[model samples]
Target: QCIIDNVVDLKVQAAITSIVSATLAKAKLLCQDVSARGALVSCPAGYKPTGCACGMGCGSWDIRTDSTCHCQCAGIDWTAARCCKIGV
Candidate 1:
């Protein structure tokens, strides 16, 4: 049997930032591609994460009818508001 010493192997926040950035970048590329093709781009302007809820919260980025990403909080109805992506 072997034991391991507890040590900070990596900066979690920094890693998270990097991962998010890259993910957004890739998403942007995909959006650009769709837009370039003159296709109707849903949520062209992009939406921020907000208002999460255990009930229909999805706890993650959700696409509203207006085509926007929203992280709804507990008891916050995302359907209440629309993203309204411009130039879509």
Candidate 2:
């Protein structure tokens, strides 16, 4: 009886582990698929970047890329003041 109980518990544990592993693998695939699309492109031309890419409703503009004046901070404020520098 003890042996049978132990075997059943082991099998249940294995099954739970397999399910968790499969869920994690599926989540990984989904993330890869999303990232393949790439981050949002610079703010469309003519349209000045509104609301901090940092997500702040409004405040100072955190210049995105140095060359261009676009940014996608993903709502995360920049640690440094400058997002990008102008001129070669």
The 0-to-1 C-alpha lDDT of every candidate, in the order given, reads 0.38, 0.39
Candidate 2, lDDT over the whole model: 0.39
- Positional deviation of 7 in candidate 1, in angstroms? 6.8
For 1-88, candidate 2 gives per-residue lDDT tens digits of 3798889899999999999888766652111000012223343333333233322332334445532232344553332222221221
Clash number by candidate, in order: 7, 3
* Stretches of candidate 1 exceeding 4 Å from the true structure: 1-10, 29-88
Instruction: State candidate 1's TM-score.
Output: 0.23
Model 2, position 40: C-alpha lDDT score: 34
For residues 1-88, what per-residue lDDT tens digits would candidate 1 score against the true structure?
3333322334666788899898766653221212111111234356422222223534544545654344445443433222222231
| lDDT computed for candidate 1 | 0.38
Q: Which ranges of candidate 2 are over 4 A from the true structure?
A: 1-4, 28-88
> Which candidate gets the maximum TM-score versus the true structure?
2
